[model samples]
Target: MRNKPPSLTESQYFLLAALLDGPLHGYGIIKATEQATDGRLRLAVGTLYGALDRLERARLVEADHEEIVDGRARRYYRLTNDGAAALQIEARRLQQAANVVIGRTRTAEA
Candidate 1:
């Protein structure tokens, strides 16, 4: 089997990370991602949907179908096993990146 594609942006990272907990609909995912990033990331509707489409195509996230909420259809998403594994890899990559920065910052301060 081929390896999963790497995350291309912070938004992609946020998307995968948000789904770490469980499945979420479009709006729920968006809100969770924004909050997780401390409001540093706010996805427009188009952007959010676009990312979802790409991720679903990649087999990372799958559409769980529509749920009626307040008399409206909301598309939900659930991470696949591959998606969870990918998220783990990305998290490790991010933690390593942070470690490098922290180490350098400490050395600079010292």
Candidate 2:
């Protein structure tokens, strides 16, 4: 049996983070993810599209509209209210986790 996917993967987190700033097309999302991760992550077209499809299904992300860019049709994506709220919660969770790690490291040094 195939393992069920997590509610949110790191890629999804990055993609949602990108939408936090504004809506973006596929290529734009790829670029934004790269920039956000400081080039640590590069999303392939297939991977990016797959993530978008799943997010749309979850009602977390919606296609705003198609825009013409360089003679190509680009579908822009925006975060829905649910998506924004989810991201906020995930961010807070991560922040709390980071604080714990920091506290551990500081104690180790002391």
Candidate 3:
């Protein structure tokens, strides 16, 4: 039997998803996640950095590059191959869970 991928928290899931398109700086990730969730999740600066640090340590994400913008260093992060696989696994898990509710709701209505 295949080992199941580890589960992700909501913040971790969204953070990784934001990197799906490409590498993004901290602020870019915050904006992408907020937009993706329709402003439901606004990540504080500390929260964002904390999550990034954890993700980096886990090897799910990496610092792609750093650049100077307006005299400040901006770091860009990209999802590693393992990150993508984990994200996909989480997505499937969520979808299956949702389908159970939807199916039950439909049956009850019928």
Candidate 4:
């Protein structure tokens, strides 16, 4: 039997989702996540970088490239195929969980 993919944390899920469009630098990721969550998730710089490091090590994400901005190096990260697959699995899981409650609510309302 095939093993199920490990579940992702809320922050990790959002971080990967933020890169769905394309590669994004640190600040871009932060902004994208915030916008995606409608400001509900504001990733602190330290937390962002820490998660990025862990994701990188897991091979779910990689440093796509780097650029020097104002003498500081900016690294951009991109999601790997594995990461995309994991995200999809997590999304479906979340939908199914939500559906359970939604189904109950509808039944009660009827």
> Using lDDT as the measure, which candidate wins?
4
What overall lDDT, based on C-alpha atoms, would model 1 receive against the true structure? 0.85
Deviation from native of the Cα of residue 104 in model 1, angstroms? 1.5
Off by over 4 Å in 1: none
How many angstroms is residue 12 displaced in model 4 relative to the true structure, after the best TM-score fit?
0.5
For model 4, residues 1-100, the per-residue Cα lDDT tens digits are 0346667999999999999999999999999999999999999999999999988877789999999999999999999988888899999999999999
Pairs in steric clash, model 3: none
For model 3, residues 34-61, the per-residue Cα lDDT tens digits are: 9999999899999999999988877889
Prediction 3 global C-alpha lDDT:
0.92
Q: Name the candidate, 2 or 3, with the larger lDDT value.
A: 3
| Clash statistics: count for each candidate | 0, 0, 0, 0
Q: Where is model 4 poorest over a 10-residue stretch in terms of lDDT?
A: 1-10
Q: Please give the distance, in angstroms, between residue 55's alpha carbon in candidate 2 and its true position after superposition.
A: 0.6
For model 3, how big is the CA root-mean-square deviation?
Answer: 2.0
Model 1, position 60, has a per-residue lDDT of: 88
Compose the digit string of candidate 2's lDDT tens values, residues 1-110.
Answer: 02332368889999988998888898889899999999998999999999999988887899998978789898899998888877877888889999999999999999
The TM-score between candidate 3 and the true structure equals 0.95
At residue 92, candidate 4 shows an lDDT of 95
User: Against the hidden true structure, what lDDT does model 2 obtain?
Assistant: 0.86
Find the candidate with the highest TM-score and give its number. 4
Residue 90 Cα positional deviation in candidate 2, in Å, after optimal superposition: 0.8
Ranking by lDDT: 4, 3, 2, 1
TM-score per candidate: 0.89, 0.89, 0.95, 0.95
Better of 1 and 4 by TM-score: 4
| lDDT (10s digit) by residue, model 1, range 1-110 | 15866575788778888888888888888899899989999989899999989988888899877878899888889888888887888888889999999999999999
lDDT of each candidate versus the true structure:
0.85, 0.86, 0.92, 0.93
